[model samples]
Target: MKTPFIVLEGLEGAGKSTVLQVITQWLEQRGIDYLTVREPGGTPLAESLRELIKKDWDERVSPEAELLVMYAARVQLVNEVIKPALAQGRWVIGDRHDLSSQAYQGGGRQLSKNMLAQLSDMTLQGFKPDLTLYLDIEPAVGLARASARGALDRIEREALGFFERTRARYQELAAADPSIKTIDAEQTPEQVKAHVLAVLEAQWPS
Candidate 1:
C-alpha cells in the first residue's frame, strides 16, 4: 500500500499547525503509521536553509532569492524525508508546500507566474499531494490571531493588506484545483478539527 501524502496549507494564524496535530492524533488513534513534517526544515540541510530564510533580517530579500531558497530547501526535504517515508508506506503530513510559494511569492511579492512554474516543475519532480487541506479564514481575522500570538517572522510581519492578497490568491487556487479542499478556519480549534476529520473521511475512507 502506498503512503498517503497530505499537505496542509493556509495563511498565518489559520490554525494549520493545530489542525495538523489533531489529524496526527486521529491517525495514531487508528493505529496508522504516519510522519508529520514541515517544509523548508524537514532535513538537516533544509533546516539550515530554513533558519536563514526565516531569520537574518538585515538584508532585504528579493522575490527571486526567496523563490530559489524555498525550492532548494524543498528539494532537499523531498529527497531526505518525504520520499523515504512514502516508500515505507507511512502517511506524511506537511505543514506547508509548493502552493505556499505561489501564494507568498507569486501573489505577495508579485513574482512572475512563469518563473514560479518553472521552479516548481524542476523542484517538485512530479510529486504532488494526494490531498491538500487548505484552511480558509478571513485575512483580517487571521492576521489578528497571528499578531496576538507575539513577535512575527519576516513573512509574518508583512502588512495586513499583503496577507489579504495572499489569502485571496489561495482561495483562487483552491477554487481552480479539485485536489485542494478548502476548510473554514474561522471556527474554534475543536470545530475546525471536526471539519477536517469530516473532510478526510469523505475524501479518503478507512
Candidate 2:
C-alpha cells in the first residue's frame, strides 16, 4: 500500500486521542509502517514554539504573532519531520494540522482570510493530508471533557464563544472539502471507532 498522510482534527476533548489509537492499531494489523506527529511540534524547535503558544503570558499576545508562530512551527515540522518520514515510505498520522489554523486563528481570532491564505500558501506550498478525519463535537460537551484534564491551556481557556466560532468553521471546511470526513464524536468510543474504520476502509482500503 502506498503511504498517505492522514490527519485527525478536532476541538479539545473531542476524543481524537482515542480515535488515533484505533488508527494505530489498524495500521499495525495491516503491517504498515507509520509515524505520529503533532502540529506545532514533532521537531525540537516546533515543540518550543508550541510551548510559547500554549503558555500563559503576562502581556497580551497579538493575534498576528500567534498566527505567525504557528506557521513557523508548521514549516519546521513539515520540512524536518513529515516530509522526511513520507519520503522513507512511512505513513504519517498527524494529531492536528493546517485546518486547526483555519479554525482557530482564522475563525476564532477573526483574522483576515486574505492574510491566512497568504501565510498558508507560503508555508504549505500546496502540501496537504491525503485524508482528514474530523471529530465533530459540541463545544459545551467537549469543554466539559477538557476541563476534567486539569488546567486549560491558553487557547483552551478562551471563552465558549471562541470555540463556538471555531467549531462552525470546522464544520464549514469539512462540508466544503471532499477529502475531509466529519465523524459524530458525541457517540460512544466504540461507535466512533467503527465510523472511523468505515471511513478508512472506504477511502483507503487495502
Candidate 3:
C-alpha cells in the first residue's frame, strides 16, 4: 500500500496542536520519515493564501470568494507539498484537509453540497486521507476555548450559528465515512489524549 496520508481535523481549540505533538513523537520514536503540513499552507503560494484569507479586510467578504481562495490554497499545497512527500514514502500528516471546506463552506456558509462535491472531485481527482481523526466538540465550548486563546482570525470570528452548522456537518460526514473517526474533544486533556492515542495505534500500529 502507498504511504498513508493521515489528517487531524477539528474545530478551533480542539487540542490538535497537542495531538500533533503526540503523533510526531510517536513517529520519531519509530524512526518513521514523516512530513507535517497544515491546510492553506505548506508552500510559498499556499502560505501566502493562508495569510490573505486570515487577514481581515475592510469590505465584507463573500462566501464564494472565501471558498475559491481555500480551494486555490489547497490545490497548491496538494500539488507542491503533499503528493510529492507521499510519493517519496514519507508519512504525511495534515492539520486539516478538504473536509474542512465541506463543513465550513458547504454547511456553515450554506453553499450547495453538490457544488462542493464537484469542486472536490475536480481538484483532488479522488485523493483523500487514509485516516482522519476528527476531534468532536460543541461549537459553544470550542468557541469559548478559541476566544480565550486571544484574537480571532477572519474565519474564526464568524457567528456562533456558523460554527454550529459546521459542527453538524462534521458529525454527519464523520458518521458516514469509515476512514473518519470522531474523538470526544469535551473530555479532559489526559482522557482525550488517551483516546487519540488508542485510535492512532489501532489504525496504524507499530
Candidate 4:
C-alpha cells in the first residue's frame, strides 16, 4: 500500500482529536507504519513558534505578522518532520495543516487570499495532503466546547465572527476540492466515528 498523507482540519473542539485516535488505531490494526504530527509544533523551532503564535501578547500583533509566523512554523515542520517521514515511506496523520491557515488567517482574519497563495507557493510549492478530513461544526457549539476546556488560546479567544468566517471558508474550500472531505461534527460521537470510518474505508479500502 502506498504511504498516505492524511490531514484533519477543523475549528477547535470539532472532535478532530477523537478522529485522530480512531485513525491511529486503524493504522495499527492494518500493520501500517505511521507518524502523527501536529501543525506548528512538530519540530523544535516550530514548537517555539507555536508558543509565540498561541501566547496572549500584551501588544497587538498585525494580521500579516500572524500569517507569516504560521507559515514560518509550517515551513519548519514540513521540512524537518513531514517530508522526512514521508520520504521514509511512512504514512503521516496530521492534526492540522496549510488549510488551517487558509481558514484562520485568510478567512477569520480577513487576510488576502492572494497573499496566502503567494506564501503557500513560496513555502510549499503546491505540495498538499493526499486526503483531508475536515470536521465541520457550528461556531457556537465548537466555541462553547473549547471554552469549557479552560483558558482559551489567542486564536481560540477570537470573537465569534472570526470562527464563523473560518467555518464558512472551510465549507467553501471543501466544496471546491474533491480531496477535502467534510464530516458533520455536530452529531453524536458515535455517529461522527461512523462517518469517519466510512470515509476512510471509501478512500482506502484495502
The digit string of per-residue lDDT tens for model 3 on 171-205 reads 99999999998999999988988988898889877
Arranged by TM-score, best first: 2, 4, 3, 1
Find the candidate with the highest lDDT and give its number. 2
Would you estimate the TM-scores of all the predictions?
0.96, 0.98, 0.97, 0.98
Residue pairs in collision within model 3:
none
Clashes by residue pair, model 2: none
Evaluate model 4: give its lDDT: 0.93
Candidate 3 ranges with C-alpha deviation above 4 Å: none
Model 1 TM-score relative to the real fold: 0.96
Candidate 1 off by > 4 Å: none
Report model 2's TM-score to 2 decimal places.
0.98
Candidate 4 Cα outliers beyond 4 Å, as residue runs: none
**lDDT tens string, model 2, 7-119?**
99999999988999999999999999999999889889999999999999999999999999999999999999999999999999999999999999998999988999999
Worst 10 residues of 4 by lDDT: 1-10
The whole-model lDDT of each prediction reads 0.88, 0.94, 0.92, 0.93
Positional deviation of residue 160's Cα in model 3 after best superposition, in angstroms: 0.6
